[model samples]
Target: MIILSVESSCDETSVAITKDGKEVLSNIVLSQIDIHKVFGGVVPEVASRQHVEHMTQVFSEAILKANITIEEIDFVAVTQGPGLIGALLVGINAAVAFAYSHDKPIMGVNHLFGHIYASQIENEMKFPAVALLVSGGHTELLYIKDHYQIEQLGSTLDDAVGEAYDKVARSLGLPYPGGPVVDKLAHTGKDTYKLPRPYLNKEEFNFSFSGLKSAVINLVHNAEQRNEKIDVANMCASFQESVTDVLVDKTKRCAAKYNVKQIIVAGGVAANKGLREKLAEQIKDIEIIIPSIKYCTDQAAMIGIAAYYQNKIEPAKKDYFIKGDSTLDINQS
Candidate 1:
């Protein structure tokens, strides 16, 4: 089946075409990072407007690159919730229009589910796996028995890991979208400063990054008051180490508790070199499945993959249209 998918969950306006849910024919993503960088973060209104401006161009590019006509598409899929309402609406409306005009089935997919299924592209996934989902707006650990069965193991009580990263970066005078920058800086520095690892000793799968974020901010503020030369790279390294320790330890403990043999790391933070290396170094005996960096972030290809799996359990209605749901849960269809 050929699936045409759209994802405007945040700052990206993306469109993708997939075949049989495993092969991505075309994945076009127009990012507004440059536009949002000046403000040090994404402005919801600005992001939504950009999505509206580029949705058509992105859709057209995806179709052209896929070398397929609208009639050839088997169904339409779009991220309907768990994201910025305005951004989600843009993709949802585009998808609704395509499905209605073409008389095709339409499936509304959860944005988080899109991240989870991203690992399925160009690869086979084993069931009964534990997935650590970390992104800008969400941090969750999920238990996946199959495509149709998923349970939330735990989630963040405050800021998501990606959000914390951006906040910490801002505190350190780094640019917006700080996860990658911090990760890169961390590689060259030493963990001289000892940052607290939040909830590392807790037995639960839940996460709390707010404390860590505050600790970094306070540390920076205190050093500035003392007129001490701040070691930016060292602070980055230390901060990353603390976050990585907590995440990897919690994930490992969760896998052991659930007795799952497979572990999948999904979402934007899965692209972190520090996190990936830590997981590889710490987690032994279980198979770890992580997508390439491209798939780790928000994209429509993942939405297409997720829609295929969603369709297998519950088929989409030909005449049904969906609206954007900003708070869509992972367990909800």
Candidate 2:
């Protein structure tokens, strides 16, 4: 199936064309990272405006890059929810127009499912797997029984991991999107601060990063108050260590408990070097699948991949392609 997909969940305005959900022909993403950097984070109104400005251009580019006409696209797939409502509507409205004009079927895909199914682009997914989804707005552990069956194992009680990373980065006077910067600096320094690994003592799959973020903020604030120098690199390293340790430990335990065939680490934070390396070193038995960095973040390709599978299980109807749902549940499908 040739799937044309739209994704304007947050600061990214993306469109993609995929063949059979496994091969991505073109995935065009226009990110507003630089624009939002000045504000320290994404501004909803700004993101919505940017999406409106670029949605048509992105769609045209995606089609051109794919070397396919709109008629060749079997169906249209778009991110339905779990994102900024205004940003999502831009993509959803565009998709609706495109679908209606082309007389093609459209489907609203869950953003979280897109993250998990993104692994299909690089590797074939195995059933009965556990997925660790860590991103800016969400942190969740999910049990995947098959392509059509996924259950939420646990999720963040407070701020998501990526949120914690960004908050910690701001406290340290780092850039807006802090995950990559923090991850990079972490490699240059040692884990000297010895930050706490929140909820590591608990056996549940739940996570909590609010406390960890606060600890880092407090440490930085205290050092500044005393006029003491703060080792930014070391602090990044320590913070990354604390976060990765708990995530890896809980994920491993969840996989073992379920006796899953493989583990899929999805979401934006899956691009973190620390989490990738630790998961590789620690989990020796089961296979671990992490998509390439491009697929790890928000993109239309993953949404297309997810929509392909959904179409296989149940074909989409025009009525199903309605307005966006900001809080669409992962297990809704």
Candidate 3:
């Protein structure tokens, strides 16, 4: 089977061509991080407009790179929900139009599932796995009972880890997309700030980054008010320590509690050097699956793999189109 995938769930406009579920033919992503950098976050309208401009060229590039014809594509898939509505619509309407034009089967994929499939680039998913989705907009703990069955055990009660990273980085005068930036700077200094790790001791898998966020914000503001010279590198180190500690602790607890066979890490923050190192140290007994950095961030190849798996459980059709759905319950195996 051949699938062409589109992902416009955020500032990145991505397109991919994949065969069956595992073989990636072509994956092209045009990032608007440069455009959104000045704002310190994604702007929905700017993202939508950029998608409109790049979507066409992305599709063409992906197809040519894949060395395939439109007729060779047996299915079209797109991320359908839990994202900025305008950004989501750009991809959805594009998929709807492509499906109409090509008379192909259309699949509406959940964005979280796309993150899960990023692990597929490395290896096939094992049953009874755990997925940690840490992205700009979300931080979710998912229990994968099987290939098609996914259950959300817990998630962020307030700001996501990536959001917190960007905000904290901004407070420290770091650039936008601060997760990697902080990760790099953190290596140069010690964790001297003693940042808080909120809700780590909580009895559930749920996360609470808002408290951690506020704690860091207060510290940063206080340093400025006192006319104190803040150690930027140490601040990054301290912030990342708190974030990594919370994530690793919770994930390890969940892995032990559920007896899961594997843990797959996904999303943009999956590229964090600290998170990866901490996870490696913490998850010694269980299998740890991390995708190639290409798959870690938002891309259509990940969406194509997700659609292939989703199709195994239930087919996505034109009639089931969804947009901006935070409560979407995508069936798992």
Q: Pick the candidate with the highest lDDT.
A: 2
lDDT of 3 by residue, 132-236 (tens): 889888888889998767888888888999999998888888898888899999999899989877865467998988888788889889989999889999988
List the candidate numbers ranked by lDDT, top first: 2, 1, 3
Q: Please, what are the lDDT tens digits per residue for candidate 2 over residues 1-333?
A: 899999999999999999997999999999999999999999999999999999999999999999998889999999988899999889999999999988899988999999999999999999999999999999999999999699999999899999999999999999989999999999999999999989745779999999999999999999999999999999999999999999999999999999999999999999999999999999999999999999999999999999999998878777745644526577786
lDDT for every model?
A: 0.91, 0.93, 0.86
Tell me the lDDT of candidate 1. Answer: 0.91
Candidate 3 deviant stretches above 4 angstroms: 316-333
- Clash-forming residue pairs, model 3: 148-332, 148-333, 149-332, 149-333, 150-332
- In model 1, the worst 10-residue window by lDDT is 319-328
RMSD from true fold, candidate 1: 1.3
Clash pairs, candidate 1, are none
Off by over 4 Å in 2: 323-326
* True lDDT of residue 161, candidate 1: 95
